[model samples]
Target chain A: MENENLIEVNHLTKVFASRGVMSKGQIKAVDDVSFSMPQEKPTILTLAGESGSGKTTIARLILGFIKPTSGKILYQGRDIWKMTKDEWVRYRKEVQAVFQDPYGAFNPLHKVDRVLTIPIRKFKLANSEEEATDLISEALGVVGLKTDEVLGKYPHQLSGGQRQRIMLARAFLLKPKLIVADEPVSMIDASLRASILNVMLDLKSKFSISFLYITHDLSTARYVSDNIIVMYLGSIMEMGPVDKVLVKPLHPYVKLLIDSVPVPDPERRWKNRIELPRIEITSQSLQTRGCKFYPRCSQRMEKCSKERPDLANVEEDRWVACHLYQ
Target chain B: MPDTLLDVRNLIAYYMTPTAPVRAVDNVSFNVTEKEILGIAGESGCGKSTLAYSILRLLKPPGYIRGGEVLFKGSDLLKIEEEELRRIRWKHISYIPQSSMNALNPVMRIEEQIGDAIINHEKISKGELRKRIEDLLVSVGLSPSVAHMYPHELSGGMRQRVVIAMAMALDPELIIADEPTTALDVVVQRGILQLLRDIRSKLKASVIMITHDMAAQAQIVDRLAIMYAGKIVEIGDANDLFNDPLHPYSRALISAIPSISEKKKLKGVPGFPPDLRSPPPGCRFYPRCPHRIPGKCNVDEPRLIEVKNDRLVACHLYR
Candidate 1:
């Protein structure tokens, strides 16, 4: 059931309960969510949402960092939660990650070479010392780093772009099938941000790798993604081909997210769209009403506040969860 | 003369480091007409921050204004003594850094910080300073009660407003902001940018915003200068630069922006900006410029000259 899809996630839910006396109720980081990674065709899919959207929880869960309370995750058709030790090793090689902060991932004491060396050794890709150095150099070269300048330099010594590239080079050296990049370029300078983004885009061509580019910036997601999935409060609001979804987004949540983004154009002022509610909608797990976005939705009504809307197909290759669209 | 509010000519500023001399702003020349917002857009290490620090005469060592003149109104900022520069700082050219959290002091209340800047330059007494601080806070759209709160108590947006209010404290002729809204979220960023815009019209003070976010620059800046390595490769009106980018670097940057609904693939310029200390001759962007031909760009240095009406570009193609 799992191997048919590259990664098949069905009803993935994570709920944490506090231990001991003066106990706390369960906190659901991720609610029942179902998604599948298509076979063979690897496109950059964006998991976009603001803080507390449970996007990060989903990433952690998929990476085997946390166990889901209910539901299952199938990587290359194997249930990841129940994978054997040997399977987990193979799984890691298939899914490599580049975290948000490039510097935080590496020890400051070690040089940039150490960052690349760890991955090669972990995967056991290199045969000998000379082969290891060659592979490191090759990875560095792909990311546009010079061995003479940055090889011996510490994380602090390299620029933000270089450090991120070194991290990326480390990931690419694994020759992973899918790369889970969590806000990979947000912390760096705006100019260097694009460089990291390009590395992900080019990797698809150079290494035949697919990227799960996670970010809050829709503009960046639009730039690098082949498909887009808009998430809201622990569940996906919409998912489809990037062209089909973004240009004509059916979900109210997706519409609001797109509207909020400051379009780079200065000529025409954006329409005075409905403002997002300042309140944090945290009472999420008790089972949602009509729509998760009902409280914040501009077109929300009495029906929206009462019924839990199901994800419906509004168009070809697009799924939206909105009452108005229905 | 348009009452040249902040006039800079041939400014040479460099970071005084143990490493090779960083010619951050090498013979860079520009001027901000009174009440106009001039933005300097460039990547990190391009010296946009160094330029802002130089104009304020606020270079904390490791960074020193190497040579050239920074004439704000009639006064030569470089020629001014430390005592004179201090008097001129908040009064003539105020500064707002990337993050307001660090710019403000933790121990003191908000009112005191605003009052301190007022007292440092003006002859106003404590009673008069309190009234002025209240007015300044109100002008920047912050509640007057905020003056009672410490820096940490307020949100990022509120603290930024406090910083803006501080920058506009003395009603300075020029406000140099280095990535003022980069730390904020989209909605918060819009609010901060609106506040800056509101102040720009009311105070009629020139704003020199140094940022790498071209989107922010397009939305706010009247004119823009694109820097590569440590040189301004292109400079023109924001609209013109975006629509008709003359330099290859500027073109690549404009195209680099991800369109929300568009499907076109973003073509990132193949290589990185050259090392400042030992930049190649001819065109500084020659290494990455796709149009680079052998003898033309590799042989001689290209100077920034007028390419079209009110637009300047530095490239052998333009020459």
Candidate 2:
């Protein structure tokens, strides 16, 4: 995996058994998902889906927050969960996460600077107080923040964009090789959304870092992602180069997602409106017969309801799980 | 006669706080005509929500309309009595809040909640209300059985439809939906937009759809108003707004949306929105405007003047 790819996730399947007394079932959050990221090259890989589509579950598995019931998450040819206590600590220093809420990440009582400096103090990467300050300042600069304005301010004092930038600064201060950003700009103002995304793009070029950006927004995914994976009902529907996947969709789910978005085109309207029921999307009751998307899929076939489709190599650099393409 | 259902003239409303007056809405004016869908686009603190709240008469405490007039169906609502305005609220003008689904009471049954709206606005019995609720659910692509369930039992899209159904209970002349479909997915967003359009055309009611997404607005809105720092800088027909945006702010917002139709780099608008408590000396957008005429735009604020035909632009370049 280390030869060219930075991480290789092979046959990744996550299963969660109900722990509470009332519930008893095996929930397959991510089922047989496989993909790899190249080394020395940083690119955005979008894991797009609606709720219960296993997008967040995949992110959790990659970060080692939850272990996959059956599979291997290879980070530089080493199993992420197989790491020892010391090794796990070292890995934590290399991988950081930017959550959805910027303000929610920190304590209400603490100042913004304290939140930014926590990892530095806990990891003990830099000795002495002065050395830690220098490292913190450097990280803040990378995310394009002013130490003067943000240092003494609390989460309430700073705007949504400022708080988000601080979160990025903390991630950078770890000097992590990869950052798993989950809905970083979803909560911010639309005007400030691009600024947050631009910082992620800037960091990739400046530090040779890789990003596993998890989002539901197709527009932002199109603008930043080099490669993308579309997930639906705990399964990978499609994965390929962003340009090919978006421009020439091989799966029906991906096509519907692309067409559903009103593209600001005054002349064109999607005449073929696919009707979707409210209850059909409830993930808790999603029991697959053949394909997970068969219920609402417009181009669904009779064969789709009887046999589960397998991800096949359709063409160069494109993988699809739809029977139509297979 | 402009055929306008609701007309707002220099609406200057603000929250009269003890520390300082929060100038939420400042001399903003727009119109929503019969069978029209007027979209108000802006960022979070751009007075978009304040304007919507003011229209609904839902403002509480220190918030008060300092000046200006709100003309709805030839009646000056700003000067109306509480009882008279209450009658007009749901029967003539109804508000579909941003999170109107969540705003629904959880304890009560679905039909009963809508029944309250129907009962408050119009004289209707339980049998009539139940039929109206069923018909409302059917119109929004939901099963009539949903009215028997609680809020938690129904899905988010279904809950949103319920809110819309309640808003449509009185067969109001106007429906004000603020970020109605924003919380849902793309597919559901399209469905909800279609539902709003269907309600507007079929019921012959005007719709005021306020949102932040420009692409989403192009789907259904007949006209658009771009607000910034408590001021409407641009207003025009939806097609004109997208095709020939005279204002720099409007152009930046339209360009920011990465759509399938266009492949150009979506250039983000630079600089933060001006602080409303103590705003800048001149133009609110001058600091960020890429085409700002340095001296003129920086020193004096521009007026919302008719630039070309039905298009209105509040920029020195247009003036």
Candidate 3:
């Protein structure tokens, strides 16, 4: 059955083996995570959380770099893990990635052109050197880089912003249906980040490409995303429209994350101080049958520590996982 | 007339390699007042970190302080002898590096590390040293029991607090923090910044914070100095700098920050900063300045001058 969704992740869970400590059980990196992207309209959905929040684990799972312990990832209404060889090849071409460290993404020893050319040749996007050159130039031009300036330079020779743009350009060449950008602009400077972010927006609007923008920075996430999924300790805390999720966050964890951001305006400094956990818990320390955020939640109910809260649709378009909301 | 803790005049530092010399910190001048938190804001490669290293006189080989005066407590740090500089370093002027985990000794306990920094300058008994270490740890919002913990055993935030405790051991008059909260998460960053502010008020110490995060800078800094291509392009009070920026680069920088309050168009400066080895002939920011006056900005550089009350700008548009 061909569902009308672009991507559906149902009960996707990934558990890694514990390291070093014998007492520590398996690390539940991602636990029962589920979401779906629509097929009709392209959307920029952000997965936001702090360091140990399993957001990156979801990205890795979607990219097929690691398989889930149990559950299913349906790509275009088909099981991605069970795809045939030819279907997998098509899936690979349709889904692309842009990573956090642009400097480390490419080999310093090779020329910058190799980043775009190899993908083009492998995908057979163009024939002949001249044809490939024209296509590469067009992709670079879309990202506001001239072929003459970037073609022959090494990765070390280009600035961090330029190198990241080159990565975006390479992804653009694939015309991928989805791009999983993990902390894409975190390493770049704030001044140059706007350009790179705008490039992603341009790609989405101009070419109908969906973006899975993963970031720890809430300000940028609010700026670019149409929808947001707040994750913590390998589970969804809240999911809704960007304004509803960020501006007026339902979950306490989401509120804390938004409040923690040091807004640029000095006039509105944080009025209240928040007490933080003395020690951050690792994934191996997740609770068996309670809210993962129960330990650190400011408004923790007695029931929160006893029974795990299911993600319930509290409002028209907003969903939250908290006993208070329930 | 105000109490100036440190005064830097025409400070120029360069990184010399086989190919060419990178003019990292060129003709930078600023004053840090007593008990004030002055922020040095700029993008990467703008020489803010180099300025921090130059102030400490810790520039390694091939990266030399070319010329300038770093006057701390009415003494020219550049002209001071090695013995005198050593006495002043860590005792009078401490530094918190970007990565606190890397700054600390992984194998050493937090209390012992703090003891090593303090006992070198003061003659204290072992018991008194432990007391002092506990007191310092408590002052930075960390529990006194954390004194015996190793760097690896603590979380990233706790390790940073440990670094802060070490920097504050001698109760230094001035602290230079280069991207102190760069790698930490936002929650941890806010806690760290709050700790720094609390320390400054309690100890009445001056701070020269260097970071590219404008939003984070707005939280604690009293004054801000925006650097571009190794030069201090604008300096003003933090509120004034954000509300009424005089330099085009500073305006673009402040505007580039994404705010969650509203969805405003963020305009990134069109081009990258100039290469320090061979910068532009006139204004270093001319290539990327949207309000550049042709022929004038490209041909003649603007000098930093006092314009409105207490604000300084280096721009042809201002003149």
Candidate 4:
């Protein structure tokens, strides 16, 4: 039997039309982005990029919160866009999201228990109130949250780390096959970030649930993700295994990003000044017939300004979008 | 400490509510020498920002400096009058506050806001002011054209750069940047950090970089101070501290940071940072510390004393 794809996003493009009269052009947020998650085993694929690099747009697209301008999202080898009402419900149940801000994600007026109980009730994971309580407690245990500490308390009563764990516990209640996390640990305290990541890794192993982890922090991404996609201005600069790409990058943009990250180790401080564009990267679409990173690429060629290089496979399991690599 | 530009001694700033006083910055002491960058590292609620606010004398109602002194260039800043402080502010000492989005006024243009800060301190002709504002913008890697744009018209990173430019507008002897690049991306963050380094070297000004990100501190900061529950747990040279953290909390904080180049089992400090309202006695980090001694760490609070050459730690293990 052929291997099935759990989630496949093919040539996705999302463009936001300029709403204000001052802005004349549309913003191409996600331009021709494509990737897939395998069905056989649990995998964590990270979409790493800077702000306005379309990481969040891809996450919103995968969650079905917004419609893509063009392309198809395949869930379990079936077209998600063409799914029926019943099928859509199943798809929604299977794929869930965990947002970055834990404080804003929850309702202040409601008790923390409400967040967990409603998902269990909506999915019909438990039959009665008693079963729901047991399910909630079990899910809470998985994310390292004690039942009593979080069950009846308000969001203000608990810390940010606790609130984030509660969100994870709620996701666990749904038993999602794919969890789309968009910078989940960015807002959380650094000391608490690792534990939450450990919880995600624990869930990945125990339940075999895949994760589409999206973040700008490369360290955490490399720590948790198996495969990585380096994005820049709504396009993939490089895509490969996490270890290979991060440890030794091929593309100039990826190399710049890696070098830019200030590692905790002071022994290897950044020595050379990174060449950057004189102007900040605007939200406007790059409509040039050339490489998008040509303005800032330190090793830009004459061909780079004239032609856009497609993401081509350069080595085994590694793809880079640069004329030099080709 | 004779060459120190900003010297904070046992500073105790607190938030007084109807019920009780929250000691946001309790007995915190450090110094920024001339032409030095002192990086204050800590988690949220650790009172890093409170310390900065207290030194700058910008504490609002319900939040006031309770005790301790801030000595800058042989004079006590905390004891100065409001009028004296107003003259000193942005001229001798300036601030780049956290969240540049809210720092810049929505109604004012970039140049006008910078001009307001400049005109308050010194007397200059209108053309000279415009030229100075443009020069400041250009020095911070921003184009002169950006001066005409409003705060909302610029991006988050651009707003942060503008904030940096405004802080350096008066050639202040000292600059306090509180989480300068917290919300910016890594690529943009690097550029901002570089700009700060350039500003420090070119102007020969002291900087107090207060942030929770140790990774960002390692890049440019000369000295590092780790805080927990409003207390400086450890203080030393940046390279020395990152290589060998004496306090258990500091050690846990350094290790908890996930590395991109290296993968290891990150042992996060378990438990939340102590609440300032009703803090536990003894050491603030005792509850979460891995090397906690039951009687010693839970009963008596450790003082930040010199353990090695130019290194100080507030843990019983060193004592």
Which candidate has the top score in TM-score? 3
lDDT of 4 by residue, A86-196 (tens): 999999988989999898977899988889877887889988889888998899999998888788899999998999999888888888899999989998888999999
List pairs with backbone clashes in candidate 1.
Answer: A2-A77, A3-A77, A289-A307, A290-A307, B16-B62, B282-B300
Report the Cα interface RMSD of each model, rounded to 1 decimal.
3.7, 2.0, 1.3, 1.3
Clashes, model 4:
0
**Quick one: ranking by DockQ, best first?**
4, 3, 2, 1
Report chain A TM-scores, every model: 0.93, 0.93, 0.96, 0.97
Q: Which candidate ranks first by DockQ, i.e. highest?
A: 4
Model 3 spans > 4 angstroms off: A21-24, A279-286
Q: Which pairs of residues have clashing backbones in candidate 2?
A: none
Report the lDDT of model 4 for residue B303: 94
| Candidate 2 residue-wise lDDT, A1-326, digit = tens | 33856677889998877675655777888898899887768877888888778889888998888888888988777789888898788778777899999889988898888886778789886898899889888888887777886898778878888899999999888888888999888888776777788898888888877889898888788877789998987889999988888888889999888888787766675566555583434545564668888888889999999888999899988999989977
Candidate 1 CAPRI classification by DockQ: acceptable
Model 3: per-residue Cα lDDT over A1-326, one tens digit each = 44468788999999988665546467788989999988788999999988878999999999999999998998898899999999999889888999999999889899999999999999999979999988899999989898887889999889889999999999989989999999999999988999999998999899999999999988999889999999987899999999888889989888888888998987878888765455545444657778988878889988988899999999998899999898
Superior by DockQ: candidate 3 or candidate 4: 4
Q: What C-alpha lDDT does candidate 3 achieve relative to the native structure?
A: 0.89
Tens-digit lDDT track of model 4 for B20-61:
899899998888899998899999999999998899899997
Using alpha carbons, what is the TM-score of model 4? 0.97
Evaluate candidate 4 and give its CAPRI docking class based on DockQ: medium
B2-53 per-residue lDDT for model 2 (tens digits):
5978989999878876677777788898888898889999988889988988
- Once fitted onto the true fold, the runs of candidate 2 whose alpha carbons sit more than 4 angstroms away are A16-26, A127-133, A278-285, B125-127, B260-263, B293-295
In model 2 chain A, where is the ten-residue run with the lowest total lDDT?
A278-287
Task: Please list the residue runs of candidate 1 whose C-alpha ends up more than 4 Å from where it truly belongs after superposition.
Answer: A1-3, A10-34, A67-72, A76-79, A107-111, A126-163, A187-199, A205-208, A232-235, A269-316, A321-323, B106-154, B293-300
lDDT of each: 0.80, 0.84, 0.89, 0.89
- RMSD of every prediction: 4.4, 2.3, 1.4, 1.6
- Tens digit of lDDT per residue, candidate 1, span B54-139? 88777887777788888877789899798988888889788897776577898899998888888877898778888898888877
